[model samples]
Target: MNQQAEEILKFYERQGKPAGQEEILGALQELQQVLGCIPKEVQEETAKRLGVKPSFLSAFIKKYPGFKEVSAVHEIHVCTGPSCGSKDALKILRALEQESAQKERKEGISVKIVKGRCTRRCAKGPNIKVNGELCHHMTPEQAADLIRRL
Candidate 1:
């Protein structure tokens, strides 16, 4: 097996052969961290090693913003729920889009920005997730700055 897959299996085993999806999610996060993305082969190897059903893993990947099938330099998710909308989440989204576009033109950085569903953290509205890491209480300028830094 490849080193990344080996590391993911080792991490899963270190977590004590956990059967719960939450525990498995932790291992997947580690995989994302080490590999920078969770492609199909890695996902299948993970499922096989960890006794997780492929369908469950597939569903989990789709349901969570943190997991992605395709690789990219960064994936930014802007929360567009009612609470975040009230907090100008759309503005943050636009800022990211514009900044990412500018960077792609100038620096050739690849970024994918998507509108996300309610994260249910309404109190911490206007949240954006960058490469699976959540950032809270964002503004247009801050979001744009984040993209520039990336």
Candidate 2:
């Protein structure tokens, strides 16, 4: 049995029936959870289920950050905003990226390091977020430790 798919379906059910665009977004996000990145077949199927146009789905996927065309098992986003950048954010990014490579071979962990404009905690400067958990006052050692333990 496809337990993950079933779980995703259950989540969709709890989300209620989306009438328009909201429904389309909700369904796509759920499918992304199950399928990693939505394939063409899944996109078409979702459009048919939601009674929305394929173009509409395409636009949403293009615009929304949550909808990814490529999926990663782990993602680390580093803030490159003025405050964080001034506080050695790039060093943290490099450290994490390097650690990701080493761990990727050792444990088969797929990591993607992304640069973000801001995480909205300027006072925290040198901020980063792993998956979705925000970290404040980042350092290379801290970043390396976080990714290594994964």
Candidate 3:
């Protein structure tokens, strides 16, 4: 385990119960600042130490924007549900993922791409949410361009 994971385990052990969402969020924020993204192993260890299932931690990471790992500037989320899929959502998603990976390799910082179910903008079809802003009717190329600009 990494030093951060060790520290988290020790802290939780001292506390005598599972860490709450706020505590986990705070730890995750610190971890992201120190280590970029939360490593899968660290997340698992954190879940174990807190006595919560890994799925719970995963769910928390998905639900809370603060827990997301991204550069200080922005984060990206794409809708991949049935409605969005009709608009070549998978292609858009792949483009964004590739863009994020390229940025990470070049800049040594991470960008997040979260896939979510309907943002209730089914009318919008393929929609994307960037830094909490909703974008409608995006093509794969457009999504890639948007990430480049960000």
Candidate 4:
């Protein structure tokens, strides 16, 4: 087992009980909290340790917000809420989508682009999240520059 698998198993073992739905969920949540995303191999190892089917965890993770099965090299989320919309957030989203496509084709780097709702930072309209880190006051040119830099 790799270090990540061992660390995750250790967390489960510390619970000192047969892994139930709650315990497994807690473990997965902890993994996401610490690693930002739960890797496929880690998820499989976790399922094995919990004595449950891999699909169960896979489906469960998908249903929950803020949990990802795999971490992309770059994940961009452009807020499309009313506040952001008024600030041209969609334009930035489009720019990032185009730039990501071009970058992937030229350099083979994987990027995931998502349209996100308000992050409750209306004062900072036109917000974008790059790899889960927030950037406020974003413009299409800035978004394109970010993709190129990444």
Best by lDDT: 4
Candidate 4 lands at a TM-score of 0.52
Candidate 3, 44-137: lDDT as tens digits: 7678877778888888877876555334446788898889988899999999998867665443346678897578899987999988999999
The residue pairs found clashing in candidate 2 are 84-126
Error of 2 at 100 (Å): 0.2
lDDT string, candidate 2, 17-63, tens digits:
44366666666777777666765555555555555677777788889
Model 4, residue pairs in steric clash: none
The TM-score values for the models, in the order shown, are: 0.52, 0.52, 0.51, 0.52
What is the lDDT ranking, best to worst? 4, 1, 3, 2
Model 2 regions lying over 4 Å from their true place: 1-72
Quote the positional error of residue 54 for candidate 2 in Å: 42
What is the per-residue lDDT of model 4 for residues 41-88, given as tens digits with 9 covering 90 to 100? 677777877777889888988888878754447888889998999999
Off by over 4 Å in 3: 1-73
Error of 2 at 123 (Å): 0.4
**Residue 106 accuracy (lDDT) in model 1:** 41
